[model samples]
Target: MPNNSLNYHNCKCNIDVMHLQSQDIPLVARLYKRSFQNHFLGHMGHKFLTLFISEFVNSDANSGYVAKYRNEVIGFVLATTSDNPFREFYRDNFMTLVYLTISRFFKDSFIRSHITKRLGHVHVALKALFSFSVRVRDSREKQEICLSRQPRLLALAVDRSYRGLGVANELTAEFCREMKELGFKKVGLSALPWNQRAISFYIKDGWEKEEASETSISFSRLL
Candidate 1:
């Protein structure tokens, strides 16, 4: 069962922070799209986003939480004590995702370009075998698959209308508490290098900067 604990009065109405239920996926996915509008994942559309977010909720390695006011989900956070969330998502949904990607590729020019770029990165041999007009998936999965049990905050999102009212703070605090209570020694997360707000937020919350690359900056906090 999901945790139905924690409530905040930072706003006039009580904001309840609890474990995410199955019914909350659509709302959370909507929030994710709104929160990451300029990102590649956001362009995947609602149905894809629905199935993507549902993987986090359904996986035993993942934990999800939501903040609500008057029973409306206004924010959500997803974490994992292991790295199997994405692996499992693609494993179970590959064919379906490929169909969706093919449909989107023909309909959306941006998706077509993105898939084209992905195709460019494939090996010459693999490309020959998969020589199709357009590639179906945008991401190339690594051939070597190894699972890790490191606790990491996967994603956090809040409704635009509900920001700055302590909703994000409560969600982060609760997520950390849940990880600690589960015997995790530490947890980490990464934000895109250009997302200054997210980098600042993690730093403000006492997550020490760990490492960085062209794409992302990593932060960690000891439990």
Candidate 2:
């Protein structure tokens, strides 16, 4: 368990949460990659974070929050809209969107060509067509899997050095307050089931689990 005695006023730590700018993207991603290294070791790599820094940092500036102390970023909260919250964001983030589309196109093209060349006679045209339809439906389903009512708090991490301090609570509370002000009725976050400490923290702060999957538990708070 984390130390419970640390308080913002008496800790002599300067905690300030603010919106991160484009220049801060690299530092933020670096900090996040370091803080979450252990948790995401087998799941993702540093280059993925580095390459997607722009998409993560620029996803939803108003909903993203970062905590700094002594001029260094100590923690961050990254979020994305449920389903293209604003049409304008689609255009603004067109570069990343296009990148995703192009990658998908090439990936599908390569897979189709490989299958056609290798199993040309084994798999009939009807079977290949059925397989292609299944793949398309699965891809679309994955893309549409979003919270219906609340925006997701996709990632949140605190530097190990600052964990015990009330920074996490402060950042989370600020996120909830901001979402409430923006007319959202609730906010959601997910964590691995093994992280009992995080689960307890969320429950202590009034977040209740609305869903549970094999690897994660989704928590939400009514705003």
Candidate 3:
């Protein structure tokens, strides 16, 4: 159980939830990497991870929030109400996208490790690439045709030390509240099927599971 008493930093205060700032990106990125180290995004280098989070912060369609305890960011969430976040991101940051693409192909050590592990099999790389492409397309189609234009939570991360402190709950509640104020009727999020803990958390937080595929489970809540 997370300690609810906010008595850190030698002061009596409550966790402060606020709009995420540019200065907080690095800390949030580091926390994200630590929290999801087994996920694909986690294997990405720090530079790429920073750029990834920057996209959300810089995008007009996206919004983010951070939870501060004693003035230090302990958790953060990023979301977008855009119908097609990936397409919008690519359109808005073409050059950065190109750079990242090229960098991944030639410079990413994680990619190299996978290639090496697969015994330099081109087919393995090709298969992974094709699978990723298909998933991306399917997600976009689902959002466009089956889902409403409500905010979709892209990423939510809390520092290990901050887990069980209600930081995640607070960040999510804030995200949904902001979405509602922005004229959205509901909000949604997706989690890996294997992430039972996260799924349970969302369910307990008032989100209902809407759909599940082999790769992910989708959840939503009416605002």
Candidate 4:
């Protein structure tokens, strides 16, 4: 069985944070879909959002957390401890996300018939092959793929209504403290660079960006 009943609460907000139960799957799915859709709605579409959330929720490699106010889900984080769920389709998702981004380039009529479509297939195939090869190599190189025995912070969101109330900070800080107490050297996150608020918050909270591209920034902190 999973850790279905951990008492996760925001000390600053004084609200209970629920460990996601399987029964909460639908609600979790809804919140996740809504939260991400709201952020990337124009960039993608309902189909993409739905697909990603479903993968996050149903995957064995992943687990989820949610923050609620008055029993209504206000925030969520979806995470994978190791590589299980992704080992299967990691490359698929990566290629899909990339394709979704560069698809406009395929509009060139000259290449659409031969180079473009073929390139997309090749990209996906190469991604999958690379993913599989890496996992096998990693497995052979290491005795164990040691993951954080402590809970890791995954995707975290504060509903707009709860955004400015410090709930996000409180939840993240608490998770960070938990990781430190569990002897983790640091915590990791990837924030979209466009989300200045999130970047600012992490920086203020002592996290630093390792790399920033036009799209995303990787963040980490020593516990």
Name the candidate that leads on lDDT.
Answer: 1
Error of 1 at 38 (Å): 1.5
* lDDT scores in order: 0.73, 0.62, 0.73, 0.57
Q: Estimate each model's TM-score.
A: 0.78, 0.63, 0.73, 0.59
- Report the C-alpha displacement of residue 96, candidate 3, in angstroms: 4.7
- Winner by TM-score: 1
Better of 2 and 3 by lDDT: 3
Over 1-223, each residue of candidate 3 has an lDDT whose tens digit, in order, gives 1444443442224778888878988987888888887766676667767877776675666787888877787889988877555554444455664566557758766665654544433343344334433344665665554345767998888777767656788889898887777567888899999988788889989999999999889999999
Candidates 1 and 2, the one with greater TM-score: 1
Off by over 4 Å in 2: 1-8, 11-13, 39-47, 58-62, 84-148
Q: Write the per-residue lDDT of candidate 2 for residues 1-223, one digit (tens) a residue.
A: 2233445575445578877667667777788767764443212334435444555555543256788775677788877555433233333444554455345446555433443333432333224334422233564454444324567787777777777677778778778887777667877789989888788878987899999998889998898
Which of the two candidates, 1 or 4, achieves a greater TM-score against the reference? 1
Worst lDDT 10-window in candidate 1: 139-148
Where is the poorest 10-residue window by lDDT in model 4? 1-10
Instruction: Give the per-residue lDDT of model 4 (tens digit) for 1-223.
Output: 1122222343344555655555555665565555654343223444344445555555444555666665766666666545344444435566565565456335433333335334555555455657644443654343234433323456777765566666666667666665565456777788887777878888987887788888678888888
Instruction: At residue 109, give the lDDT of candidate 4.
Output: 39
User: Model 2's lDDT to the true fold?
Assistant: 0.62
lDDT over C-alpha atoms for residue 210 of model 4: 84
